[model samples]
Target: MNNLKGPVRVVGTGLIGASIGLALGRLGVTVHLVDADAESALMAERIGAGSRDVAGEPQVVVVAVPPDHVGAVIAAQLAATTSAIVTDTGSVKSKPLVDAGALTDDLSRYVGSHPMAGSERSGPLAGRADLFDGATWAITPHEGNRPEAVELIRELAETCGARTVELSVQDHDLAVARVSHLPHLMSALAAGTLVDAPASHLELSGQGVRDVTRIAGGDPRLWTQIVAANAPALTTLLERIRGDLDRMLIALGKDDGSGDITNLLMNGVTGAVRVPGKHGAPHTDDATVLVNIPDRPGQLAKLFADAAASGANVEDLRIDHSPGLAIGQVELAVKPASVDQLVKVLTERGWVVHR
Candidate 1:
């Protein structure tokens, strides 16, 4: 695709918008960050996300607001940037598309997009330049959508290192309801159960519990808006999962290992294993080491340098930190065979190895 000359306007400086700005900026594309809150727009720009103000008409406009506000925001943005092609990163597309269509006659330049990538964080500060790397971005084009507009959005996703998957609006909602929305609801419910339990109960939690409830920490206001917007599809998917869960409970009550409940659980495990990795290949089970590093300048660089010097290819990394902590735990995922070598390397470099 040929590089467009005009600036790209991102109309919300949340995590998704800021990330898009960062990716576009890195591609030498001028980006204008526009948010209702001037502070948020300024913050995004300060973090190298984009320019602070909306310049003349942008070539492309991305609306990245909360679900509840996305439709109104997109309409406003479309009106403001009369000549620009518009798209959105809202989780639910049909509602916003319908709203935009009903509210305006200039629907030709609008396409709906949802990038299947995020962390349990919000706002510009939580934005990462590599957030969209190797993720799938869903493009939902309606009858009124211009081919050029859709292609431009696809190009944007490609530039940010995301694979483009075209889906009908209905299909996109259904798929995300099953894979994304349902899981968020489940995580929230699972975490809610522990609210009344004693604090000591948390100490006994294992990785399984942690993994299941991890997304529960996401912004509740944001999720509330999303779930409400996509309630129909999300509720439908949740009912299916609830039915399966009921069957499992009944099977356990009957003490019957021969029931179909085992198959249901096995299907979930198999489905999870089918999710592709960064290189678009199935992920393999691997071991990981947790290294505790002091929260000081250049500590992470030192650890990574030491790991490379010792000939360890870190497969993945997760950092756990808290406010004002002197140290943070870094979980380094690696090949099972390489764990020993990695530990040896870190220990030799005078770093604390937590296993």
Candidate 2:
């Protein structure tokens, strides 16, 4: 693993920021946590994110503040630091880069980065060292950017177990507007519709509804900042989706055997399958096994043990549990070739596997 020569400074000890600090600190590099909220910064330090004070000139500085505040924070950090290579973990980049350009004449030392990793949770207490593991981190270098500085930021990301991708700021924002931002908005909308739903309707909700609405539980304040910052791209994407939904509705209401609705639904299925998997590679033909696990201690451990003994690699997994359900569904993703083998192993071991 690559190491930094000097202490690394992390601004904003929220989930992403504190996570960067923790990951770097674990790699034997001294990390300095600088947040506008002193107590939060101190709490991050307490959780092993980094030290409390800026001891000296840091070699690299990561700005993990909210998207709206990223530009100002990056500018201030660049002005204050002696000569550190500065980067950010904000979700949107183009606007911040433009804002930074307006704030400072020296832009060579700064780079814009966004890690495609986060949970619905927020704050320093929610940070985990492995938050960036196997996730993509986009690095955007502008005209005045220093090659060394860009490489240093890449090294820092690699050390934190993130796969780095180079993209123009515009491309990054536009792409995420579809895959990330739009999804958050969709989930929030879907979840909001349930607010006035009848109690019986809510009780009937299955894993599918819950899965699609998970991001709705995120911090509203943070999301308000993100959605507002990336409004232009998100609005465009949403408009397209709106048009498609309108067409689908019209097609669904048609009495004649119009194939438009079927075609649209099929297109959505095809689009979803094209999404890359954990390693930045396309997922292969695979099957997911849903196991209803009892809500008790050691149930998850036993499930994993059976899976391991089955000689099948688990590509992905998700657990769905509600307040009153005695059982939670564990979705285990396995290669198509190994599905039968895993099913036999699981069934023979007496674990209830969903068909």
Clashing pairs in 1: none
What is the per-residue lDDT of model 1 for residues 198-310, given as tens digits with 9 covering 90 to 100? 86777677667888998898888888888888888987887887898888877777856555777887888998888765466566666778888888899999999998887
Per-candidate TM-score against the hidden true structure = 0.78, 0.88
Q: Note the Cα lDDT for every prediction shown.
A: 0.85, 0.87
Kindly provide the TM-score of model 2 when superposed on the true structure, using C-alpha atoms: 0.88
Per-residue lDDT for 63 in model 1?
A: 93
lDDT of 2 by residue, 1-355 (tens): 3546658889899999899988887778889898889999989999999998667789998998888889988889899987899999988988888788789888889999989899877899999999998889999888888788888989999888899999988889998898888999999999999988999878887779988998888888888888988888998999999998999889878886379888888998898888887565576555899888889999999988999898999999989876576878898988878888788999998888974
Clashes of 2: 0
